[model samples]
Target: MSSYLLILLLYVFDQAFGESQLKLVTVLYRHGDRSPVRAYPTDPYQESAWPQGFGQLTQEGMRQHFELGQFLRKRYTGFLSEPYTRYEIAVRSTDFDRTLMSAESNLAGLYPPNGTQVFYPGLNWQPIPIHTVPQDEERLLSFPLSNCPNYIRLMNETEKTAIFLNMTKTYGDFLEMVRNKTGLESTSIESIWSIHDTLFCEEKHGMTPPDWVTPEVMSTLQLLKNFGFQIMFGVYKREEKSRLQGGLLLDQIIRNFSAAASVNPSGPLKMIMYSAHDTTIVALQEALHVFNGVQPPYASCHIFELHQDNESFSVEMFYRNDSSVAEPYPLTLPGCAQRCPLQDFIRLTRSVIPTDWDKECTVNTHSSDTDVIIGLAVCGCVLLLLVMLLFIVLCRQSEPSIGYSHVINQSDDHS
Candidate 1:
């Protein structure tokens, strides 16, 4: 009897302790390093200098993503199938060549060909579909979306803040220096960063730095560049800005998690991966209140993991910033446990998540009024044109018909 009791106890303990299971995972990663999108007017290396020109991925970029893929494969060893399965995972990327190519490179490491799946002999790669919408239509992975008038207004207001003013005053000399050095016509905060970006990329690739680009200058430029990024997404009205920018992505991720935990779950997409820009990652992080305030490095990845135990579900987040690190750092949402309950996660993030993105994007009364006024003016112009056309037709009808008058004269002459 005691033996049977012991067996029952053991079974119960095992059931209680081992019941937790990982259900779903979502990952958003920035594309790896690339050539500069543009060079300074005086830059020796112009568009023609790069092998594939500006804005394309480099060889190092492909390797970074491939290694990241391998890391994913190891991390989800048993959870994901050994062989590539279309139903098990879905990948999405921005329409840009670098992001799209990064997704392809990542998949190559994640899903190597196995067991009769080899299309080309000795080649481990098999074509996996990486989906994307047109760039203009992309809302989920794009940052600082153009359609949001409220965001634009917020940015304009942010520029007027004392912090921005102070920054401009502080960096006025540096900005002017860069303009003179680069031979560029304009040297706004936004444009000056491109010069730093070009210099940084060139230095990374072992090219000699220009004589004017001293270490002190580069450091100052980096600081300004980071400041520019902060103001773009986080300096003013960060939460509201997130509602229009990163919140869209967070809302979608939350929805995916909730759907996976539903009683009636949909198809078998266990993992969803997003290949995007650093801004996309920063935006989402800011929305989650986890932004570190620095620019995300190349190939940085943010992971959202879902876990289920008994009748309860929870969410966990991790950030992998460095490839050499043995493990990703855990991120805890404020006001919640490390493994936050799904309900709590949703509730905490509800404010940032927009109910109607388009409606929220047009929240500015001034913009709405302007739109209304413009619409009314256009309608008035169209109405006036229609009325003028009608008046011309009426005048023509009222006039003595010329053809009829000619016919009458001829008849009279004949008589």
Candidate 2:
């Protein structure tokens, strides 16, 4: 009797002493399925074949995000209130029709207008602002950024690695056949993904591939495509490449986590959402050192949940690339557990999160420096031509031209 009483007291004490609370959630997801961006010259279908033309989101895409939003609503039932509050959540997306619509669709499911939020009786949707910037100006969430010359050099270096060289050698003849058959000028490891993408998109939409696209051919193409994704961030010197590519996003996630932790129960910010692309997911998972090496499928999502337990904080991550699974797969940082202490999580990821992206992205190679010099030289030459034209105009204006002063006739001047 005394033992049972002690056990009950201990249980009560444990329950009353500390509480674990959900503080914040960050969700980064790829836009749902889209129409093929384009087709090869020799392809059977062209831009006229797809609905609303190239690279637009499909109805299926809308349904995917809507379901995902429903999943989130169920997952965070008690944490997120029924009606949406602008103060509780913030959303951002890449400036594209597909992503913007995906975010809108996701929000439609996550926060359907209820009671006070319902402005209309007929419609269940409410207008929520999703912020975006022009594509060219975007630094965050863009992958394999072309503006970074140093990153280009890294790709150059990566190609020389043994794995890359072996793949190139093995696929050389196949690539030649692809180039000849598809009317591409050339097909190499770098550009094979485009062909694969066109084929994959077609197959997904119930369109059969050409006669040449056997199952074995499709398998090989997918292998090469996955390798291409690896090349962008993980083939060689993965961490450094991530520092320049995906680390920017990871840095933001940490910042938001820190912000949530500092304010604790007082902060109104409960969730942050980013609607992006497959490459965005790849870059981020690679930075986290938790990528499974498979291409993130459409509607794939990465989740970061910040928890406050008593006086300490922790972060848990999940990847939901497979819709078949009832729950998202738990993700752990390379050197940490599934529920990593906030300080440990930050420390483990310190190397990948860049301190100065521009400085780190700078290359001191002679060729790159020469390119810079050449660019400067071209600018100087253009400037000099402009100055000479201006001087000539000023001289003619100040001391009138001989022809201007005399008004010489054409015959008189010739004579």
What Cα-based lDDT does every candidate model obtain? Answer: 0.91, 0.90
Q: For all candidates, what are the clash counts?
A: 0, 0
The TM-score, computed over Cα atoms with residue i paired to residue i, of candidate 2 is: 0.86
Off by over 4 Å in 1: 1-11, 366-415
The sequence of per-residue lDDT tens digits that candidate 2 reaches over residues 1-415 is 9999999999888777666789999999999988888899999999899977989999999999998999999999899987898899999999999999999999999998988788989898999999999999889877877788778888999999999999999999999988888999988888888999899989999997889999998899999989999889997999989999999999999998988888444468889999999999999999998888888988999999999887789999999988889999999998888999999999999999999888878886677789999999999999999999999999888984556355669998889
Residue-pair clashes, model 2: 0
Model 1: which ten-residue window has the lowest total lDDT? 401-410
User: Against the true structure, what is every candidate's RMSD?
Assistant: 7.7, 9.2
Q: Model 1 lDDT vs. the true structure?
A: 0.91
Predict model 2's lDDT versus the native. 0.90
